[model samples]
Target: MSKIDPELKKKLLKESQAPFKGLRKIVWIAFSGSAFLGLFIMLAKIASGNELQLNNLLIQLCACIVFPTLLFVDRNKD
Candidate 1:
């Protein structure tokens, strides 16, 4: 293997870190949006006078859990 120059290594480090600066904000937004959507669905059902069904709620919970889990798994793979 060839030795890497110091300046080139610094440049590469900066470039690698750049993409992650906004990643935290993006992840929070995605999670919040999903939670909001789930809440909206539950509220709509209540507003329409339907009984809160366990299956429906379970599905929403699964969606909330699954989405973040997928995001975490994908990010770690990199």
Candidate 2:
């Protein structure tokens, strides 16, 4: 077999290392948006004096906190 060109080989390696980078970004944005939206809804319920279930409030709070923390960690990895 013929040898591969050095530049092309390097590019291939880089691309392979981060396959689906664009898709990953889109998923991250979607999750983060949903997390924030859930948090907003919870806040609105509180403001309107509607009682919230404990588990749901906890889950939303965790989602709101966890997604951004993960995003921050992922960013600093780059």
TM-score of each: 0.42, 0.76
Q: Supply the TM-score for candidate 1.
A: 0.42
For candidate 1, the C-alpha RMSD (Å) to the true structure equals 5.9
Q: Which residue segments of model 2 deviate by more than 4 Å?
A: 1-8, 76-78
What lDDT tens digits, residue by residue, belong to model 2 across residues 1-78? 749998999978877987876676677778889999988989999999999999998998898888777676655253
* Weakest ten-residue segment in model 2 by summed lDDT: 69-78
Q: What's model 2's TM-score?
A: 0.76
Q: Which residue pairs in model 2 clash with each other? A: none
As for model 2, its CA RMSD to the true structure in angstroms is: 2.5
Candidate 1 worst ten-residue window by lDDT: 69-78
